[model samples]
Target: MDGHRIRVGTASWTDPSLIQCKRFYPPGCTSAEGRLRYYADKFPLVEVDSSYYALPSARNAHAWVERTPDDFAFNLKAFRLFTGHQTPAKALPKDVQQALAGHFAVKKNLYYKDTPAEIRDLLWHRFENAVRPLREAGKLRALHFQFAPWVTRSARAQDHILECQRRLAGYHLAVEFRHRSWFEGDAAGDTLAFERAHDLTHVVVDEPQGFENSIPTVWAVTSPKLAILRLHGRNAATWNIGGEAASDRFNYDYSDAELGALVAPLRETASLAGETHAIFNNNYGDQGQRNAATLQALLDGA
Candidate 1:
C-alpha cells in the first residue's frame, strides 16, 4: 500500500435491508443525511446504486457532499437508459415521456436506440447537471457504465461505446461489460486494449462462475490511475432469474475464509494501480457492511 491508496466499502448505504438491519447506524441517526454521515465515518468511499434505478438529483448530490468529509468519495452508476438497458417509461421524466408520446404510441419500455438523437442529447445534459455538484465538490470518484448483456462484441457495439464516452466527456468513466462474448477466446486482449486506448477503467467483477452472463474474474488492470473491483456475491441460483429485485440476486455473504483469500490479490492490485476500490455489493441483510469491514481490517493489519 506504499504507492497505492486502497479503499474498501459497500455498493450502497441505504438499501432497505441495510436500514432494516439496524446495527450499522446509531439509534439517533435515522435520517438519510445522518445515515450518509455515519457510513462516511466508517468507510472512505461508496458507490451510489440508487442513481442507476432513477435519475440522480443535484439536490441529493449537494446533500451528500455536505454530509461527508472532504476526503470521502462516491462512484455513481450511470442511469439505466444510458447504458443500453430497457428502461420503463414511468421511470423517465414527464416532459420526456410526453415528447416520446408525440413520436409514437406509448410503449412500456424504451431502449437507448429508441430515443431520437435530440432526446438523447437532452438526457446527457440532465445527467451532467445532476452530477455537477459532486464533481465540483471533488467527491465524484467515477461514473460507472455497466453495459447490458446484449451489447456484445461487434462493430456497432464498439462504436456505441465510443459514442458513450464522447457523450459523457470530461468525466472519469469506468466500463463494465456483462456479456461473456467480450472476453471469450481471443477477444479478451482486444477488450483490454480498447479500454486502455479510450482511457476507460475496466471494472473487474467477482461473481458466480459458469453462467453464460457471468463475466470471468479477470484480474487485469487496464487503468493505472484507478482500478475498481466489485464483489457481487456468488449466488448462482438467482443470478439470472427474472422478476426478482436486485437485492435478492446478490444475497450471499462472504465467509471469513473468502475475505481472507482476497487480501493478497487485492494488495497486488493496489500495488500496481494508483488507487484501488473494493466494493462489496452483497445487499442481503447486513452482509455487505460486515464483509467490507472485515476486508478493511485485514488490509489495515497487513
Candidate 2:
C-alpha cells in the first residue's frame, strides 16, 4: 500500500458514461490491454467485474498483466453459486455438499429447463478453477462471495461460508449479505466475526432503493482491512423497474457533492484499514470515469 491508501481505480475504465464523457480515456477506447494500460497509467488498482460471468481467456489475463505495473492489484467477484445460492440440486443438506457444489458433476435431465444442482456444481467448480490463474499470477486482491437476496443470517449460510473459506485453497474470501437478517445484532456480530476469523475482507455496498438489495450495506459493516465498496447510484423509482426501460436514470452524472459523500467514507476506511478498493457501479454514459478522476484527485490530495 502506498500511504494509508495504496491505490484507487474505477471498477471498469469502459463504463458507459466514461465512453460518453471522455474524462480520461476516449469512448470506445478499451481492449483488455488498452484498459489495463489506462488504469496502470492512472491509479494502481481495478475491479474485474467481467469474470463474474463467463470464463475469460488466458490471453486476456496475460494482456492485463502486460499492461499493468508491478504494484497494481485486481479484485474479482467469485462465481455466483459458490456464495451459497442453490447449486441447482437434489435433496442435499446444508453441512454436506453445500460449498462443495464445485465438486459435483451435473447429470443432464432432459425433462427440465433449469440446470440441476449437480450440474451447477460442476459448472461453478470449473468457474472457480478458471479464476485461479489470476490469483496465481498475483493479480487478485480478493474473491467476493456476495450472497444472493435470499441468504439470511441463518446457521446454514454461516456454516456454508465457513466451509467455503476452509476449502478455498489460496484466496481471500469476502462475504456480502443481501438480506436484512444478516445485519441484526447477533447475526451481524457473528458474520463480522466469521470474516475476522478467516481474515476475509467484507464487501461494502451503497445501493439505490427499490433494488431491495443488501440492508446495512457492505460499507457500513466492513472492517478497516482490505475492502470492496460498490456505489450503486440509487434511483428508488427504478429499483424494481422493468420495461422498455426508456431514459435510464443511472446514466445521470454524480455531482461533486455526491461523489464527495462516498469518497469521504472510503478515505477514512482506507486510512483505518491500511488498504481499500472503491468501485463505482453508477455506470452511466461517462459518469463513472469522471467520478473516478474526481476521486483520484481527492485521494492524491489526501
Candidate 3:
C-alpha cells in the first residue's frame, strides 16, 4: 500500500436503514454501544453524521472512546446552524432553546446570522467543549464544516471561514463547499489557496453534478495534514429534492465502476497529504459499508 495513511469508512454507522440492514453488525448487536463496537472493529474511521442535526455531548464522546480501540478515529460533522444552514429550533438543547426566548417568535428554523452574538459565542464554546473528550482521547479526525448551498463564494463568505478557523484553533477542520461557485472558475484556485493558507482541509467531494448546489469533483489536497473524500453517490434526481431526509437524498448505491474511477485520484491525493480519508456518504442501507470496504481493498492494492 501507499506510505501515507489511507482510511476508508462510511459517513455514519447508525443510519436507520443501515441498522435494519442487519448484515454489517453481527447477531444481537442491537444496543447502540454494541453496534458501535462492532463497527469500530470493521472500520478504522467513521464520520459522525448525527452531529449535523443535534449538538454532540462530551458524555457520548467519552462513551465512544471507551467502546472503540485506541486507533479508531471519528470525523464529526459540525452542527447545521454553525455552518450557515437552517437549523430547527427543536434540534437545539432544551436549555439553549429557552435562552433564545427573544427570537422564539421569529421562526422555527434559524440560521447563523439570525442568532444573537452572545448565543453564537456560547454555541462555539459548547461545540468545542463537547468535542474535548474526543480530542483528548485522540479519536477526533476533524470537525467537518459542510456549509449550506446558498453559501456562495464571496468576500464575506471567505471571511466567515477565516473566522471559523480562528475560533476553532488547534482543531483539524475540513471545509466542504456545497455551492458550485466556490469551485467553478478562478474561484477554485482562490479557494484552494485560502484553505492552504489557513491550514483548513479542503473536503474533496464525489457528488451529483449539474445541480445548482453541486461542487464538481475537483480532486486536490489543500492541507498537508489530511485530505478527505466524501462519496455522495451520483443520484442527481433526489440530490436536490426538498423535504427529504439526508439518507433519502444520498440513497444511490456506488458501483464498482464509480469506486474504480476514484482510485487514481485518491492515490494521488494521498501521496500529497499525511493521511487521506475516503468516506462513503451514500448511506441508504449497507451500501456505504460495502462500498467503503471495496474502496479500501482497491487502495490496498494501489
Write down the worst ten-residue block by lDDT for model 2. Answer: 106-115
Candidate 1 C-alpha error for residue 114, in Å: 1.0
lDDT, candidates in the order shown: 0.88, 0.63, 0.89
The per-residue C-alpha lDDT of model 1 at residue 205 equals 94
Model 1 scores worst on lDDT over the 10 consecutive residues at 101-110
Candidate 3: tens digits of C-alpha lDDT, residues 172-201? 999999999998889899999988988999
Cα lDDT tens digits, model 1, 210-272, are 866778988878888789999999999989878636788898989988988888888888888
Of candidates 3 and 2, the better by lDDT: 3
What does candidate 2's lDDT look like per residue over 1-302, in tens digits?
Answer: 45566455666655544554566674665665675676678767777765543444456666776678777887776654565444333433343345545544453111112446665556546656666667777777777777877776777777778766766666777677777776666777777777777777877766664334546664543455576676656666655455432225454456777766776777766766757777766666555556777877776665
RMSD of each: 1.6, 6.4, 1.5
TM-score of each: 0.96, 0.76, 0.97
How many clashing residue pairs are found in candidate 3?
Answer: 0
Residue 295 lDDT, candidate 1, scale 0-100: 91
lDDT ranking of the models: 3, 1, 2
